[model samples]
Target: MTIKSLGNPYDGDVDLRHGLACNCSDCADDAGHRMKAVSARDQRTRMSTDDMLDRAVESAIVRSMFGHNELSRRSFAKMLGGTTLAAALASVLPIDKVKAAILDEIGTPEKTDLSVGFVPITCATPIIMAEPLGFYQRYGLNVEVVKTAGWAVARDKSLNGEYDASHMLTPMPLAITLGAGSTATPFLMPAVENINGQAIVLHNDHRDKHEDVSTWRGLTFGVPFEYSMHNFLLRYYVAEAGLDPDRDIQIRVVPPPEMVANLRAGNIDGFLSPDPFNQRAVWEEIGFIHILTKDIWEGHPCCAFACSQAFAETYPNTYGNLLKAIIDATQYASDSANRSEIAEAIAPTNYLNQPVPVIEQVLTGRFADGLGNVRDEPNRIDFDPFPWHSMGVWILTQMKRWGYIEGDIDYAAVAEQVYLAADCGKVMADLGLEVPAETYKSHVIMGKTFDPAEPEAYVESFAIRRT
Candidate 1:
């Protein structure tokens, strides 16, 4: 007689509801025990050896329990606790308290003796300072801040694994991970470092024709880096004015301070730079301030905390600590009382390569926004620039349109791997932070509003943006 096959013995079977299946290798090997269990439950005194055994079922249950037992975490409370406001009066809050909170959740940071790269600070300088400031070390990482020539070098090193993670240009992590400039990586950028400190520096000679907003030409501008987020914003904003950026004007790459020299020397017509250069440019009479980068893509995600696919997978805890450190720095930066120290901290030649006055203007957001609006107001960088996936997805779409990725790529699925919001939250919660909503897009920053729901539409809305 032909034997009838049993279909998935433990799958939704009523008789098997009380029993685990014989899927365990150990159970399968124990034929004698299998026979005993089968015989014990037999309708007849004896059963065929072919009948499945209960010993096999018990083993499966045991293995499952063993698997679940391997899931682990450091305590969450230890990771998130900080008293920046409450302990502000103390001579030293000794970051250890915050570090302890982070470690309680993550155990230890991932990259010890890590050589992380950071660009010159405009706004995105803290990720570099956080290390020597003893923040990352306090959280259990022995980090070294390596300065690259600029954003492109930092990004290339990160991709080559010469550096663990970089204080990358807003789009570098996205572009590289999407396989834009090279091979695809599952890059991880867990938290916001800083934003709203960028500006469009006008030439010392050319008057900003806000009067002719639609057709202001003769601008050969300086971009900090060719493919940096600044380039993207310039493109989108120019497009909004119904101008073809590629055809209408000239775009060139120059370092921040070099912008003034280039403009003064007439090397370039104008430049977009971040502080202290932007601030100094205005204060030192280098140029008429054209616009704040914040004014263009207000609340735009500027710099992100990025790691490699290899680093993220291997050392999630370390990555989590890195996020906590950046968040802690943000909290410090946000307090009105802490502004002076933050400026001084980032100013020292050890960090941003700028003067305290320049760094202070940036931290304080005291720079002229170039639209007859001198914003001596709240810090513009958003601390909880969440729904990081939304940021990446938007970036991915821009990348794809620009031919950064070749074939059809799933931006949604890919973004999930890079940002790691779940881990970011865990670190925040562990440090006693109330997690903010993961945002898809931030519309208004420094009193600006973006249509968060439709970034693509917004991108398209810019009459000046190029295809």
Candidate 2:
């Protein structure tokens, strides 16, 4: 809500907007009169939101100190009302000086040494490459890229402040912020690390079933997390074929590393996961690639660079530097010429912990599909740091479609608040990358158009929505 929403909080002829108490017929008349007198003094002198909030705080402190007790303080404030007390405080208190002191330490880094948590997947390539490629150090940062066990651990570490930032799925920050699968916290996704890097892999025996999704009704599949693009996209793919995801099939949350083992042990038939695990499974002769996520949504975001909103506000300089490093690394990774070198650099024991060739195949987009067929697709996986706000809206639509979130949602507000598109655009523009002017972009998924402007209608148009 806007500051104007505080209207009618108290009954009086007082003009709260200009912080004046008067028994006038029209508050706007009084405000205009005062503004004319003030404008004659200085046109540039104006009250800011910070100044107003600080004045409120000072007023509370003064009331608490002078009143007889807590009940007496409440009675005193209620007796005078908002406008009267505000005017009384403005006469007695030095509000502007207090506001200036409160805001004195802004726009500087509170901490320098920091840790960033990431899962060992190609989706986190931008975050991982930032350290070795000197992007982090170039921006006056000492960053430690910690490889976590899974998304859960990464989320926990970030929530507990063990890591200053984290590599997260595009939807994790939204889910965390909404308290969908965790406690509510204001999270921010400043940049998307990689897009279209995931694929669906099935056993070799069921290769024919991949063509006809309806034939795979009773099959069990795996995804990396409950609030993941893999799960949502997989469900969309299957449900489009007239199969219910909740009843017609079972989708279990399995870490990317254990997907192949789960398939080999007959625990799951296939998994929609990130590479180099998908490439690893194929190289080990366990599973064959069924479809790449790019085939579903060519430029879909898979992972993001996320941090709590509190951290960003507390360390503005450090957060900007971090965004700079990530955006620079993403631009470097987006080029096709740098794929091989990146594969070699990240496919070590400390990083992805997989064979270099497997990582190479994933990065280069040329691989054996485990069905005795070699494929060459250059855009199999790509890196673009722009966290389009439309993508956030779409993810929330899916969350509502599958019952992950409930009730009415302000889709645009949530998307705009959580996804740092404006900040990302600034970084991208500084790096000489093409930045789009519009915050929302329309896309087609499974042959259905999703208009970000009307997310609710898009969710309702679905035949399989839980809502």
Task: Score each candidate by Cα lDDT.
Answer: 0.57, 0.78
TM-score of 1: 0.71
Q: Which ten residues in a row have the lowest lDDT in candidate 1?
A: 68-77
Tens digit of per-residue lDDT, candidate 1, span 1-467: 11111112222111111111332333345434334333234424322322322222222232222221111111111132223322431334443344345346446444445667877765565675464333553455545666566776777798888888888766776677666666777677777666666777775556646445455465687888755667767766665576666777788878664766777788887666666677777666767667767666656677767778788778777666666667766655556565665565455444566667766767766656444567774654434524367666666656544444555566667777776777777667766777766535445533435544555564554444333
lDDT measured at residue 463 in model 2 versus the true structure, 0 to 100: 88
What value of lDDT does candidate 1 attain over all alpha carbons? 0.57
Which runs in model 1 stand beyond 4 Å of their true positions?
1-106, 109-111, 368-375, 385-387, 401-409, 438-467
329-351, model 2: which lDDT tens digit per residue?
Answer: 89889988878767765665656
* lDDT, model 2: 0.78
